[model samples]
Target: MAVVKISERGSFRKEYIRWWKHPEKDIQLFDWLDENERERKTLFSPGYLRDRRNPLPYGLTKMECGLRAAAALFAGDPQRGQDYAANPRRFSMSVHDHIRSLRFKYRRFNSKIGAKVSNMAYVDIQGPLLQKIDQLMLVECPEWIRLHFHWRTDPYYNQYWPKDQPTAREKPVQANAPERQLRKSSPGLVNQKRALQASAVRVRDGQNKANSPVMELPTPRENSNSGTTQVRSSSTTQEIETLASEGGHASVIHGGATNLDGSITSIQRLELLIQLRKLDIEREDKKYAAELQRAQVEAANRHQSEKHEIMKQLADYVTGGKGSTGGSSTGRDE
Candidate 1:
């Protein structure tokens, strides 16, 4: 930590207090406060935690202590500052200490500034800390800073500490582990899993329906009884429509017994309808061709008859004969 002169301490403390008391303070401070509140809830909640066992902590981690000290210094809490300065080691507890000790011992160490120093000198560390916090408040907040971002991973915070210094709140990275540790499942993968499960259930239900027995249908006959034919046809049509609406496939229909009505499923009925339509189209085409051929033959015969009649009239005029007889027979009348 950088040391500041005695004369500047008062101004730094005043600036710190002003920043804390400002109505429109930095958004990062609010975010940090919210994160602290959430962390406190998680730590004290009656739930299973991977790193922590006891609901109540015996000592505060370094990160926790730094947050507390910052809040105290900003709030102008003299009693909290005095308490922390007197027992620095108690708040600056190592996480490894509890991990190593089966009985969870919380051992305290001597303060670096020495206990013999005056109260004002011991609290002088606040000047530099307050200046650093003020400087940090001016910079833009990074998106990655959250409940998991610790002093060990923060380059700005770690600049003052030694390279090999261990953070009590952060666990050491394992050699085989990835750079970033994920504590929660990805939301996208969870949604995909749920969709797959739902689709599987729908498929299972479809299969069960296909395996069940179907009701028998009335058979249609080619007899001249119009009423009987109409009844059977209507019943079969209704049953086919119901099956079609249910979205039954060919495979599903085939699984049912073929009864007197040919056990024809809705899909089979549609296929038959298509075939019948094709046959009707073919019949109409053949009928049209036959009519066209008859019209063409009649036209050719009429043309030949007219040509013959005209030839006969021209030959009679050239021979000067009335009808087929010579003209001498009508001389007396002339």
Candidate 2:
């Protein structure tokens, strides 16, 4: 530690003694007094601090005492400032204490001088002071001096310390191991075997219905007995057959018909022949009607033309007879 003998006549110690007597004389003095009162209240209060030991030395103001106490805590000895540089914490704390004591005392003496010293003090002590205090408490501290004093015994220190309690990786039991195994299996294997068997039975029943002889009927024959060829009564197959026969007759009337699937049924093929014959008869009837109308119109026009020709011939014949008789009478008169 470097032995820095701060004399009673030094600027810092002198200003501190002066302000201690008259606290309200300067604004800085008043501020230090209020800060000292608050700090004392905190240290003496029941809920604030567990230990009530005064950390400051005797014969010093609160600010000066606090600086000296910090130096003594980190320094080699409180009586002599020696062997301080050997320990980084001690050296840092001593420097911080000297600077802070000087700053407060200077503020009490001269405001302008205090401001300049404070700026320089921030540059030198701010980073080192925080680092040293944080190491002492084994936690992080704030950068600002006011905050450092405000929360001197940090509650966040124990909270941020690495806890000894176990984490999730340390636990043995897993909550979702069974669910994870279920997800890894195929969906087909996951479903019950009984359900798959029931589905297969239903599909087989459908194929049997499609291939059964009861659903397929024999083709119609021209020479076969019509009674035997007719569908059996009291059967769903019979009803379908009757509907098919009716559809055949509709196709005969309309010339063509189709089933729901757009394919021509057996009934539609039989009806198509009948429809072609009906269409031929209808075409002959239309041709006869048209020919009759044309003949009627031609006969009426020929009759009118003949009547006009007969009237012109009668007028010419009568004029010729009259001219011939007049010429013969003129010859007899001559």
Candidate 3:
């Protein structure tokens, strides 16, 4: 067997009729109905809903009943309908009061209600007002209302208005193609390049001077041929010799010899002494050869004396004398 699932339809129409006839089905409904009836009588009169006081049944069609119910729900109390018909401010004040009450009740709890309350409060009145305004604009006055009412005055209303007008500040215009190239070749850029080159040239010239060789006193060639390799003077050479004999051992030598004349003399003196060292080594080798020969001759004489003494002892032993047997010997007559 195939079972069909079905849902019972909820009749907003029936709900509306029930609320209208009884006006006390739900506690919220009862309170709202009593409050609405009080407000309606205060704004209108007790006879407002009745056709006659004596006999005729107070008749209302289903559509009227629905409309009244909807108006009461939107206004937040039934009495607000009478106030709305009387004056728009009364209806607006009622809406504000209802929103304030909802906000207060929802704010008491620290739960999800706090977040929903603001939106619920806003929509409760704002939704109906917007719908009514839209209906009026569409059916009643389209152009007149648009021209007179600056809908943008209200932040909420401006959101729904047509967006055609331009904003106050427009975007800047981009430079034309030729203008861009012109900017690159401007005189200002040309001057900047020239300034940079001049600064670089000055820097290069300064560094070159720092590394250049300094001039010194003239040598023998400068005085004689004026072109050949310059030989230092005798006095300068003597000063160089003195500095070289000092053995490059002094830390202050460089400080004292910074002058161009002193530096040249010191360098030449060092070179001459190195040459003298090579010559001195060869001379010492030649000088020590005769002493070495004398020492070798003296060593050979000592060795010969030792060998003669050993031979004499052997001769004595072979002759079988008492001397051979280790006794002292005296001289004998031939």
Model 1 off-target regions past 4 Å? 1-262, 321-334
Give Cα-based local distance difference scores for all models. 0.33, 0.34, 0.31
Compute the lDDT of residue 113 as modeled in candidate 1: 14
Per-residue CA lDDT of model 2 for 1-334, tens digit only, reads 1233334754543111222122111222223433454433322222211122343232333434444333433344443334433433434334333434533433332221122222221112223332332222221111122222222232221122124643222322232432233222212211323333343355457865344322232232355465653432124234333433333111111112333466433222222222333334556768988999899999999998898899889988999999999999999999
TM-score of 3: 0.16
lDDT of 3 by residue, 110-226 (tens): 121112221211112222332332233332222212111212222122322224543111222243343333222222323333433443455457755333221121111224563
Name the runs in model 3 displaced over 4 angstroms.
1-268, 287-291, 319-334
Q: Best-fitting candidate, measured by TM-score?
A: 1
Candidate 2: clashing residue pairs, number: 3
Q: Which ten residues in a row are the worst by lDDT in model 3?
A: 13-22
Model 2, residue 124: distance off in Å is 99
Candidate 2 clashing pairs, residues 3+ apart or interchain: 1-82, 1-83, 1-84
Tell me, by lDDT, which candidate is best.
2
lDDT of 1: 0.33
